[model samples]
Target chain A: MMMQRRLTTLFALALLSFVAVASSPPSSRVVADSVYAIPMLTLRDQQGQLFDFASLRGKPRLVGMFYGSCQMACPLEIEYLKHLQRVVAAGSGKSISVLLVSFDPARDDLAMLRKVAGEHHVWPPAFRLARTERGDEGMLAGVLGIAYRQLPGGGFSHNVRVSLLDAQGRIVAATDASGRPAPAFLRSVDEALKNP
Target chain B: MISRQLALIPMLMLPFAGKAADYVPIPAGQFESALAIAGHAAKLRLAAFSMRSEPVTNAEFLVFVRQHPEWQRGQVPSLLAGANYLRQWQRPLEPGESVLPDQPVTQVSWFAARAYCGSEQARLPNWYEWEYVGAADATRADARRDPVRNQDLLSAIEGTSGHLPGVIGTRPANVYGVRDLNRLLWEWTGDYAAMFPNPDARVPGSVANLALCSGSALAFADKNQYALMMRVAALSALRPADTAPRVGFRCVREPKRK
Candidate 1:
């Protein structure tokens, strides 16, 4: 009788362990093709809240890289993105999340991120200005087709590139983010938003 | 006590077991880069750092992937590495017989190179650091002005195409004690894309049209620096995820901050 009782308890334990293993977070099941699979990146947003870059998964969003101290092109990039957000919303009646990561992590502290967010009137849960607190943001930039270099002077020479990613963190489209959004890029964004 | 001392033999041999340990120190200096751009100064003041004497070989990288399986071919994220990442390898964990163990590892993405460097507490050298070291020959630093040496290097580069890269250290070490910087294979710089050569810098709004800041357009300082220009061109053509059979990388270790 005791042996049977022990066997039942062991079987229950095995089933419980199996359930626990199956219920683990989906992070372990990261897709090999997704951008989030390039090692976990921890970031501190404009509001100074620490979050994993991978946590931004499960929602299609726009991503770009900029430095807070950038004078000409970066500010223009912010305005251009704002215009893009407004257009996407007016056409689809749905808001798109935007993440602007800073490539100059040495200078883009929490205060600088918050300042940039305030200067552009962009806020969290919709538009977030974040800096890398732990991992290499250069890897992130490389994946998104953004390039930056610190010039001999205090300023930086960089290209403004923004990417539209699906909920699976796959880049669906990209734009130089210069003047106006390309029609084809807009169409891709629309398709992604619709499916997401 | 004698037996206990004998048991320490394996631990002593561990440090010399891998080929990844030969790093030579490079002195800091203000060097003129060939691809100087407008608005950005051509002269770069670099700090002292240690650079790997030779590029990482296939055998060393295979060991690296074995320890870090996430970086192995077919397991790495496609966004970080392309379809050709380590395609020369026989398998994800094996380099096979055809892929020589001593040959400098090619077909590796920049991300993978950076990761391998990070494992060794180093990173890919910036372009200026690379240029400074590459300007050196066997005896003299800044040998770019030597026409004979330039022609010889140009010939070597021309001979490299459509052929397998030779083993590392085939040539004598440069003045910095570094080998294979200019000849064997093209290498990845930490900021290659930043050196994008806008075709017509004289044209107004061309820099702005590309959305590159600082009004900088890459202009070669010396027109005769064709070898260096070819290196820059090769690096500029590659995306971070893309890899070529002729491109490999060496790592640098910056001085620790106080």
Candidate 2:
């Protein structure tokens, strides 16, 4: 009977240790378990809404990066995303959130962002155009495997990348879809929305 | 006299104090870079800044990890660091026997390096800034014109390719009193990604092909400077979260206004 009581005490001590380990702070929890799960970044959208980027984890998102004054692939990138959005809605019968964060925070202010959105016919609620004040746009670009360089003429040279993030904010798939919708990328978007 | 003597005590203890970082002033100037801007060999006007005299050491990084436990090995998220981040450390907080206390801390991701610099209210130097400072020798600010100096730098790069990096500041300081810019290890720059646009982006898909074809091609102003070209190539190949055995970092700060 005494041995049985000792085992019960040991079990209780083990349980307490487990609880203590599990209750560590959120920072210790490794919130960015995947590239899409990058830590919360506060950004101002075209609509002037201060959005918490981390809060979008529960919903599937189509994410890309662009600039307001980009005269090259950025326009095609927007059109490709718009095409993907329509394809995903038709394929999965669910509208996915599309987010394009600007790399040119110096020029892509609220007025310019709003103008770009209107030109692209991207209205918020389904589409969001955002910019960061703290120069972390480079950090985001790094995470998404996008590379951009500012030219001497105030234009930029950058790669085209569109990533499909799952409901948990982990990248399901990404593609170099410039001017045309990549079939595999559209299928991945449909799959994510269907599962979510 | 007694008060002056007491003041010397604190100054003497300053090196042993917990503050491990030391900054040396780099005067701003117009310098010609090996990389061209806007399809022309334009001189860059660099801002005055202060640079760490040496790379961050293992012992110093240990103190950093202790204070910010989130950056500790195995505790850092995979998204911010690769599997080999701080893999050489003996434990989460210890640098162990394999890693010497004075050796430059390598196998650090760009994200980790940025965070470490952030802790000290500094940032990583841009590629242009790094290239400008790296142009110096022990006597001259611009040593690329000297063939002997160029050969010596090439030999140094070849000699240190396979081996572990030596202790920081073991080599002589440059003209600006900065140490280990070329002799020790390749470094992470703030604008490393901006140096080389991905080749895939130049393909004919959208207007990007026309916009970036000539300006963004892999063209270097001084192609014969193999050491500088190799550094650019090595840095451009890495992602921000990726870590390498031979890559380390130092921090830079804007000069305080008088």
Candidate 3:
């Protein structure tokens, strides 16, 4: 019996070692379809017009998820993601947009999403504040792997992760915005795009 | 002299021993197990790993309670204890009885994940390192047919609402060669919940005022539940502790020298 448990431990250790080696950065190839972008409903833009991911299917997005009321990391994360956009445009000479999704659906209405955009000096088509529906907020929580519970007055506990998707609407990568190195990730994506 | 040359040949072979490097860069969901297929990640200098996975399960967590029992946040760690380790696990039946052994463990506290990892001669994967690991692209899942892709079922069941945990393993491994890195549950890392420099989400300003005011921050960082947003918020705090229900872990190591 002792030997058997030892074997199990050995097995687990071996598996972990093999896994550790097998896991590494992906090589340039057909970018996988990981990030799923099928929007539950058409989100409204700053002007309250329907924003369709399908319409922009061909281009990739540097998507950001945050609430308008957040005064801490969310604002900073949003700024960082936008900085990637700026850096991407400046370096690659190509246009990429950031989509800021709010965790606080109750607070972030169409008007609120737009107000935050304006306050931050974001330009046209640079970013979109996705309006939340009754249950849609939970839907997003699932899609993005971000979880938050509503606090007493109206706060939430959430993480900062920004996703990158290829033109085919698959999840390419979801970068952690907590201590995110946005430009490095973008540079890798830029490299992936350049390949082939 | 011929025999002496033969002995030298064996010495040369000894230096080139062990498993051949299997680092292949492919999209997610293509490899059989993301964890299984990923090669050694970028050298883990200064990066630490959680001793274990997320939400250490009931059966596993119960064992923890048996040892320390003080982690219940002033409540009895064993109060809800059934057959599981910690009393924290609530669904899919208890451990050794459920089908979630491979699922990302949940319901852990930083304290718990930390303790477990240390005992095993491992540590929590650092935040950036974990991100780089989870970021292993999975869009090319079918070709690899990895167990990590098993998470697809949960997402499909959730109906694109992105609310439920995806089933484990049906996709390829990321470049890190990690399996099931994404779909099991939000994992715990050594990073804290608060932003940089401070690294203490448990502190007042670490998490936003919303979670800070209600004392939910404690529960938020409970290490169980793997509550996506809360866990993400805790990324900045990085408090450390022992294991819990719904929490399990994988270990990382540097590539061995030839």
Candidate 4:
């Protein structure tokens, strides 16, 4: 009888303990979710065709920001992207995908962005241009993983970044055009391609 | 500690991260600098950084100039005249775009640039720091070249393609965790004397005055000599007296103010 009573008491303690543990939030020691759940954007090019980022999953992507009228940084950006392209192609004979998103969507209309697109020789999957709207810009901005703030003076301030989405559509790393020094971005993309 | 508290007493009157404008960093080349510019609503803060690997951008400068028009007229602090090379006060382009919103803000005097920094709650960087980042020869020189964008980029309105609309906030940033330090426009620095040929005259009146020099000593002794001549040439380029269509500026924030 005593033994039975002891067992019952032990069982009650175990149940209480389990409840106590489960009731509380997960402890810091517990393995947590990954830090980055980088998102992919859904966009349409100047042609108004559906541009789904999910389709580009599985390879490293390079994105450049500029509008048609950008005199200073845009040209340099395009120059460096092309330079990065040749260097990567020369080394691996693999062509990388480049995206040009016009922050000035109002002026960089579909036709205008397309003209720039055609000028860049962008077709199907090689290179592309995207025009965004102020209303849906958040969605586009969210996927690119950058935040933009419009200044009172009609200018904008945004976190300037190029996110390299892995094949799984996870952002592996982000780099600045000037920050990577060419070799790093080229080597990284090539490396990401091979290992992936 | 007491003085610091006194400084904060005035700040206590202001809101936290008060309505300063936001700024995005253009990425620099190579391993990114851990430094970040935090933009919480209107306030922009340069988190403590080891060094800025790139010069400031035209877009960033435009914010400063617009907030402080006095900079446009060159009524700002300077130990010497034209200490900071502010070349132009610019108007926009063409029939509709006369304000040149997309062009880099130019014609900023060093004094003006400094005032802009102060307004942003930041400071212009010392010449050593500015030169170190802007002049460093890194592994990559700007290598990307899109022929179409290049040929068509110039303001050749009334040409085949007419004009390409000016764009802001859309260029790829550099790797040093900086944006558009080069090719976009020239950056102003706090170190004018060290940068110009006339080191003696370049010294700010604040520093020179501390040493106790008279007005005669401060004047440009000669308009001759290559040094003086170069000073004038650079001055023409750097002074805020003239506003150019192409000039722009970047700003720096000094932590732990003196």
DockQ of each: 0.38, 0.33, 0.01, 0.01
lDDT of model number 3: 0.47
Residue A14: error of model 4 in Å?
45
**Candidate 2's residue-wise lDDT over B148-225, tens digit each?**
877888888888774568877667899999999987899998777667554346364432232342333355777667
Candidate 2 segments exceeding 4 Å error? A1-32, A36-39, B1-16, B37-42, B198-218
Residue range A150-180, candidate 4, lDDT tens digits: 3323444433456565555455565545423
Candidate achieving the largest TM-score:
1
Give the candidates in order of DockQ, highest first: 1, 2, 3, 4
Better of 1 and 4 by TM-score: 1
Residue A150 alpha-carbon offset, candidate 2, angstroms: 3.0
How high a TM-score does candidate 2 get? Answer: 0.84
Clash pairs (backbone) in predicted model 1: none
The alpha-carbon lDDT assigned to residue B32 of candidate 1 equals 83
Better of 2 and 3 by DockQ: 2
Q: Count the backbone clashes (under 3 Å) in each candidate.
A: 0, 0, 135, 55
Best by DockQ: 1
- Candidate 1 is graded, for docking, as acceptable
Q: Assess chain B of each prediction and give its TM-score.
A: 0.84, 0.86, 0.44, 0.43
Query: Model 3 over residues B46-164: C-alpha lDDT tens digits?
Result: 32222222223333434444455443333322211113333334432333444343344454555455554543344555444454445445454232224443344335323433222
Give candidate 2's whole-model lDDT. 0.79
Candidate 4, B111-159: lDDT as tens digits:
4455556565655654333323432222333322334332332222213
Tell how far residue A113 is off in model 4, in angstroms: 0.4
